[model samples]
Every structure is written in structure tokens, then in C-alpha cells.
Target: MKLCFMMLTDLSKRFNFMNSTFQMANGYFEKHEKDLHQLSDQIWDNPELAFKEKFAHDLITDFFIEAGIGTVTKNYILDTAFKVEYVTGKERSDSTISESDLPCVAFFSEYDALPGIGHACGHNLIAVVGIASFLKLCSSLKATGTPARVILLGSPAEEGGGGKIKMMNNEALSGVDFSLMGHPSALNCCTSTITQAMEEKRATFHGKNAHGTTPWMGNNALDAAVLAYNNINTLRHWMHPSMRAHGIFTDGGKAPNIIPDRAELLYYFRAPDKKQLKPLLERAEQCFKAGADATGCTVEICEKSEAYDSVIQNPVLGRIYEKHMENMGYQFPPKDEKTFRGSTDMGDVSRAVPAIHPWFLIPCGGAPGHSVPFAKAAKLPQSFKNAMDSAECLAKTALEVLQSKQLFDEMKRSFKETCG
Candidate 1:
């Protein structure tokens, strides 16, 4: 009890610091709340799938330009990827300015909607929060001081496009000191746990096609594909509890009577971490080979994208952000009882840098994310306020990261050690 009280007291002091800074700059976000919610709702109304977010991309990029942040590149690393940068320094006020000493903080925004379920994942709120953070930060910096660099990354196709991986390969996030984003969930302060045990790998298999009725006359690739799936299912019981493998039949056959010579299956194998995941993947590959050999079918396996290593949450940064959240009157439940069943490209970022993907609560009576109920809740008045709150919290959190040299150093060290 005594220890808990002391921790809360210290947290209160930090919270007080965040609130003072935010209050002076809150008006900008407050005045823009209606516009923010409307933008979010507009995204909900026009849901676009992965790699095809033309409508979403145009709306958000236009808004960023209107705010004076000018888009840097569109279709940057992918068909729908883009980046917007806003750089400021004390030297900018005078005639002399040197760019070498500025620290760059990046804000990542994902706006792709799920197929057949527009904004069902609340990406609308996600987009607004990113903009809200930029707006508040701009207002705060105008009166007080400016940070080194503020980057608004408009990463598209997070639904399944692996947009961040593409951006990373292009060296787009090279100079970013830290990246931050918030995800809406059933509760606030949902801390992330590092699942360094297994990694996820995507593989696809292909085989020749033939007439279905005269199956013996030609190779039935679909049969070979089924055999591979059965092999994986049979092996599941013998594997570790954490081991998981599943696949979708992308090409079962052309017609019922035709011995479809070509068939395809996309499979994913996950283990606690890369070391364990590697062998499992190799073993799964052998199963596919065996299936092809048995059914007289040819096989082809393509890795969909790079494996996402486990997350490494920065505790110091998390606690600081948590304090700011609690100061803002947010309460979090215990992690053991909370449930988060989805994954993110941010997990890849966490593996590479000191990061945190904290959950903020928006009411749905324990509704699951990416569901119809959650989607409806996302448009509610409360949901918009949560978006406002998320913006304030993330901006305040970024300010803390910028102002505290000691904390900033600790985060960098932690990232090096964890990623190494």
C-alpha cells in the first residue's frame, strides 16, 4: 500500500506537468473537434481495402497540406504510401538555422479499412488522433518552443499490405528518433507484453491444374494442397503449445468437373520468436514438398513479407505515457483479464526501436475490436472525445520524450539492447 501510494504520488507530479503544457495548447484541438470527427466519419463512409486507399489518401493528404505541413512524397514506397514532414528549430526564428542538431519525432498513421467492413477497425479514429497530435504540438510550439523535427507519416494499406516494411526498406524512417501511435480498444492503459517466443511467416504453395472429372488423367493440384494442410494440422498436436499454422485456399480449382491442375494455398506459421519459428517453417515446407511428391504436383512457396519479430515495449516511456493518461483521468484494468487478439505493423517498429502501442478505451461494453459494434461505437460522441483525448495524450507523451534528456537516452539505449 505504501509503495503504491508513493508511485502514484510521483506520477501525479508528472501528470501535473503534462496538464499545464496541454491546457495552454488545448484550444486548437478543442476548436477542431467537429472537423476531426467529420473527417473520421467520412473515412467510415468510404471504406477502401489494402493498397487501394485512393479516397482515404486524398482526404488526409489534402488536410495535412491545408495545415501547412505540405506532403513530401505520395506513393512514396508503395502505390498508396505517403509522408509529410514539418521541421522547426529555434534558429528558424532568426536568419541563421542549422539542421544538424534537431531531433526528429515521427507520427505514424494507418487509415486502411478492412475489406467489406469500412472503418470497422476504427482507423478513422486513428487518422484523427495523428492529426490531432500534430495540431496540438503546432499550437504548443508556437507559444513556447519548437522541437527538432515533427514527421507525419501517412502509411497506407496496414490492413494487409505491410506498408511499413516497404517504407523501412526505402530508408524512409532512417532519422526518426522515436515513433508513437495509439490504438482504440475496450479499455485505457492496456500495456503491451513482448511476445519474443514466436514469429509469423507467410508462405504460398502452387500446383498444376487438370480436368476434375478425369482426375487420374491429370495432376489434381487441389488434392496436393489439401494434403499439405492436413499434414500441418496433424503436426499441430505434437508441436509446442505456442506453435500455430494456418492457411487459406486461394485457388481450390477452376471448376467442379475439371481436374484443376493449378491450386494455391497461403499459410502462416508462428512461434514465440524467430529462432523457434525458423525450424517450424522449414518443417512446414517439407510437408508441402511431400504433398506435391505424393500427388504428382509441382509446388511453389513465396514468402509474403518479412517476419515480424516480437515486440519490445519501452517501460520508461510506457510509464511516462501511462502517468500522463492517468493524469488525464483514464483508468486501466489488469492485463491478464484484458484481451487483444490482433497484430500491427507497429510490432515491427517496436522490434526496431524503442516504442509503445498503448490501448485507449472507447466504450462498447467489452466489445471486441474490428467488429460491427466497435465500428458503431467509433462514431459516437464519446468516441470522438476519446480521439481528442488520445491526441492530447500522444502529443503530451511526445513532449515528454523531447524534454527529458535522461528519459530520451534511456529509451535509445533500451532500443539498441532490445533490437540487438
Candidate 2:
């Protein structure tokens, strides 16, 4: 009976600690709810393309500074990128615990909007939730005397530029123990489905120009471009169902009467993993070469951007997030259910450190992503509610990691075992 009493008492203390921490987080969010909503709405109103989010960069940075939060603008050598850091428990620290031993957790926010459609991917919501979560976590840590470090990374150009990839290369995540972010989607999921690795290439064909009357005098670059497109279409028959190869003709020809000297085709290659993506890329290149051979033209293929690796989810961290989200009345689909298949630079971050990029639901009135309807739905009341709930979930999960060394270690172990 004494042993039982001890166990119950310990459990009660833990429960109370967690409850107080959550209450503090809730209070922070409630206090700043209006400002966060305005930030989200303002970002949505002024949509900026990749690497050109000056307005968003200034808005968020100024907010942090005015609130007395430590911020580093133009972080990782990117003009639009920034970082916010908050530390607590230094004065109340236990003599036994060293400052260097505290775990550092990171949250990523992406604010760049898509061309023509503006926030069609709900990146505005992502930025708001990320900032709110970071603020709440900072407040919770200070109020509870928890010795922890929080970081919020303002990542840009996730649409195509791979800003996170550049940041990782610059050692921006050097001391981060874990990275967390959530994307807006039609379904709520703790783990995103396996995203295919992507490689973009541009093939330019060079040939001599000639008049239409003397076609024999010119090697038609347009013919080479057409052949390349056809070659890819034929290769698709032998490709895996998950593998995809698609291209667009950027320059077909000058005119019908004059044979063009140059033609260019841009192609995107995707596969289940980098290992599989390599051969597919090689095969696609061969198709381009075959076009050049048949048309008597020379071809140059250049990679458009760095390859995006498939996401390797850390299930240990995912379970903690799943529990918090479930407690918030969010229901996720079964694991076997198809998750939205989309590539992100966060995939690269996951491979580098323990990371979680869960998806939160935003009702789109039956519209899919990258659509006008979806962009409009980002401002709906339901979307804001979902964002706030997701923020709370992320904060709760981060608190668990900060307070429990065993849990943090397990997360790292799971990441190494599954990702490495």
C-alpha cells in the first residue's frame, strides 16, 4: 500500500506540472490571439513570391522586436529568412544542471505565397501557427521555470526555391535537438506520407538555323525538343507507378518560316526515394540525348534546383504530437489511408536532425491545394481554430520533450534507427 501511494503521488505531481504548463501556454495564446490573427490576415493580403517576402519579413521581425523577443534577421545568408530565440530558467536553474545540457527545439515557418494564386498552399497559416506556438512555448517555459531553449525559423521559398536546404547547408540548425512544423492540408495526420524525391532539369538544344525553304541546311532544334518530349512519354510505360517524369517546352522555335537555333525543355523527375530517383534521372537524360542524336543537335542538361529527399518521419516524436492533437478533438485517418504526396525542403531537415512535419486540416469546401478556393479558405474561422489548436498541440509536445530526457533520447534513437 505504501508503494501504491508513492506511485499515485508521483503521478499526481506530474499531472499538475503538465496542467500548469498547458494553462500558461493557453493564457499566452489568448492574450495575443488578436495580434496573431491580424498578422495572418496581413500576410495573406500581401502575397509575395519566393525569396521576395520583404513585407512578411519586416512584419514578423518587428513584432518580435516590439515584444522584446530576441530575433536575428536575414539569417542563414538569406535576405528574407529570420530566426527568433527565447531562453528561460537561467536564474532558477539547478546547480546540478548545466546550461549547455538543455535541449534546443526549433519550429519552422514558411510564408512565401505561390505565383498567381497567393497563399494557395496556406503558407500564411503556417507562419501564424509557428509564431504563436513559439511565443506560447517561451511563455510556458518562463512561467514554469523550465530550463529550455526555443527557436523559430522563418523559412521562405518552399514553393520551389528550397530555402530550408540552403539553411541546413549553412549549419543553421547546428544546436537544434529537434525541429517541428505543421502544414495545412485537407486531412489531419501525425506523419506525412512518404514524399517522393524531386529533381528539376532543363535541357537546351543547340542547332544551326535555316529558312523553311532549305530545311536540309538546318538541324531543327524544335524537332529535338519534340522528340525529347515523346521519348519521355514512351519511357513512362516502363516507370514505376509512383515515379513521374514531366516536362514543358520553354522555347519551341522562332517561327514556322525560320528554323530556330535553340530550343529548351524543362523537366521534373520524381521517385519514391533518392536511390530510385537517380536511375530515373539518368534514363530521362538518355531520352534527351537520344533526341539530340536523332536531330543532329547538341544538348546540355542542367539541374534547376537541389534534389529534395524523401521525408523520414520520426515516429517517437509523432506519437507525442498525435496524443496532444487527439486530446484537442482532432481525429486522424488510419495509417494506411493515403496521405497527401508532396515534397518539401523539410525532408532534408528531417534527414539532418529529428523533425516532425505534421499536417493540419483546413476545410477547403472540396477544393484542392494550389487553387483559388483553397486560398480563400485560409481566412475562414474554421481554419483559424484549427491553426490555434495545432499550435497548442505543438507546444504541448515540445514541453514533453523539454521536461523528459528519456523521451528526447528515445526520439533521437528512433530518428537514427529509422532515418539513418
Candidate 3:
């Protein structure tokens, strides 16, 4: 009977500690709510393109400095990328703990906006959520003496630039054990569908130009481009249901009366995984070659961007985050329910470290992503409220990972089994 009572008491204390930590974080966010909202608005008002997020980058890094957090700007050779670190726990006089030895948790902030639509993907909200969570965690750690390190990474060019891959090449996540961030979406749910690997291919067909009246005198490049498009379309019937291939003609011809000297088609090929992507790419290249052979036009295929790998959500991390957000009053759909499907540079980060890119629903009235209406939805009052809740949930999850070695170990084991 005594042992049972003691066990109950310990459990009670643990619950109290968790509750207090969450309360502290929530209070911190509430106290700085106005500033966070202002920053979000500022980022929204000035939408920057991939790798050109100078305004947003400066705003975030400056905010970190003002908050007394240590920051390193222009990290990993990316001009717009920055890193912020906050340490908490008993201060060690001797140099016992190396930077790499300490358990490091990372949060990614994506501020680059979409072209023409401006914040259409709610990256403004994403940026603020990551920053706010990091700030709140910093406060919690300082107040509670939780021995851990937190990093806020400003990852730009998530739209298509593969900034995370570049950072990985530079060893940005060398010592990081875990990475996390929340994406604003129409539904609040843990990711069920894995993002596919994507690669961009551009095929340019070159041929001799001559008068249209004398068709035999010149090879028609437009005909080659059109045939290539049809070939890809026909290849679609043989492709797996999960495979996606789409393209657009960038240049068909300058005038209708002249045989086109050159034509170009840009395509994006996506597969469920990188292994499958390679074969699909081979087949796609063959389609382009077939067009060249049929039209007697030479073809040049060039890779436009780095291939993006599929996101591998660490299951342990996902469950912990799902629980925290649900405890914060967010209802999530079942795993089998339909959810949004898209790719992110977070996919690359996950491959490098245990990561979770949970999606939090902003009250967007069911608007689709990357649209003008979605951009407007990002500024709504309800969206800010949801953003605050997401911040708390993210911070809470990070606290769990930081404070519990068993939990962190479980996350790592799961990452290796699933990701490997």
C-alpha cells in the first residue's frame, strides 16, 4: 500500500512539472503575442522569393539578438540562412560537455514566400511558429534548468530551391539529434502520406529552320517537342499510380509561318522514393529520345534542380507531437484519413536527423494551399490563435525530448529502423 502511494505521488509530481512547463511557455507566448503577430505581418507584407529572403532573415535574426539569444548569421554558405542557439541546465565550470555531445534539438523556419501569390503557403505563419516555439522553450529551459540545447535554423528556398540539402552538404546538422517544425494547413493532422522525391528535367529540341512552305527543307523542332509531350503522356499509362510526371512547353515556336529552330519542355518527375525515381527518370529520358528519333531533331536533356527526397517522419517523434498538440485542444484526424500531400526540404532534414513536420490547421475555410485565398487566410485572427497553440505544442514536445533520455533514444532507434 505504501509503495502504491509513493508511486502515485511521483506520477503526480511528474504531471505537475509538465503542466508547469507548458504554462510557462504559454505565458511567454502570450506576453510576446503582439510582437510575434507584428513580425508575422511584416513577413507577410514583404514576401520574398527563395534564397532572396533577406527581409525575413534579417527580421528573425534581429529578433533573436534582441531576445538575448546567441545567433550565427549566414551559416552553411547560404547568405540568408542563420542559426540561433540557447543553452539551459547547470553551468559546468570545466569543459566536460562538448557541443556535439550535448543533445541538440533543432527547429526550422521557412520564410520564403511563393511567387505572385505571396505567403500563399502560409510560410509567414510557419516562420513565426518556429521562432515563437524556440523562444518559449528558451524561457522554459532557463526557468527550470533543463539540461539541453535548442537550435533555430532559418531554412530558406523550401518552395523548390532545396536549401536543406545544401545545408546538409555543409554539415549544418552535424550534431543535431532531432529537428521539428509545424506547417500551416487546412487540417490539423500528423502526416500520413510520405512526400515523394522530385526532380526537374528540361528537354530542348534543336533542328534546322526553314520556310514553312518548304517543310522538307527543315526539321521541325516543335514537332519533336509535341511528340515528346505525347510520349510522356502515353508513358503515364505504364507508370505506377503513385508516380507523377507533368510538363509544360516553355517554347514551341516564334511564329507559325517559320519552322521552329528550337523548342523546350520543362517537366517535373516525382516518385514515392529515390530508388523508384531513378527508373522513372530513365523511362522519361527514353521518351524524350524517342521524340528526337521520330522527328530527326537532336535533343538535350538537362537537370534543372536537385532531387528532393521523400520525408521520413520519425514515428516516435510523431506520436509525441501528436499527443502534445491533442492535449492542447487540437483534434487530429485518424491516420488513414485524407491529408495534404506535398514535398518540403524538411524531407531532407528528416533523412539527416530524427524530425517531424506536423501540419496544424489554420481556419482557412477549406481553401487549398498556394492560392491567393490561402495567403489572405494566413492573416486571419483564428490563424494567429492556432499558431500560438502550435507553438506551445512544439515547445512541449521539444521539452519532452530534451528532458527524457529514454524518449530521445527511442526516437533515434525508430529513425534508424525506418529511415535506413
TM-score of each model, paired residue for residue: 0.87, 0.92, 0.91
**Candidate order by decreasing TM-score:** 2, 3, 1
- RMSD of candidates 1 onward, in order: 5.7, 4.2, 4.6
List candidate 2 stretches off by more than 4 Å: 1-15, 26-28, 94-100
Residue 202 of candidate 3: its Cα lDDT? Answer: 95
lDDT of 1 by residue, 184-240 (tens): 887775455434333333334454555666566787788888898888888887778
The parts of candidate 1 lying over 4 Å away from their true place are 1-17, 69-72, 92-97, 194-213, 335-340
| Candidate 3 C-alpha lDDT tens digits along 259-360 | 998999999898877898899999999999899889889999998876798888788888988898887788888788744376777877888889988889
Most TM-score-accurate candidate? 2
Cα lDDT tens digits for candidate 2, 1-420: 111222223333554556677675555566778888999999999999999999999898888877776545654469999988777765555556554555688999999999899999999999988998897788777777666678899998887788899888888897788888888887787674677788889999998899999999999998998999999999999899989887899998868999888999998888887898999999999999999999999999999877888787788888999998998789988888755376788888999989888889899976777899999999887898899889878887887777765676788889889887
Clashes found in each candidate (C-alpha, N, C closer than 3 A):
17, 0, 0
Q: Cα lDDT for residue 393, model 2?
A: 82
Quantify all predictions' global Cα lDDT against the true fold.
0.70, 0.83, 0.81
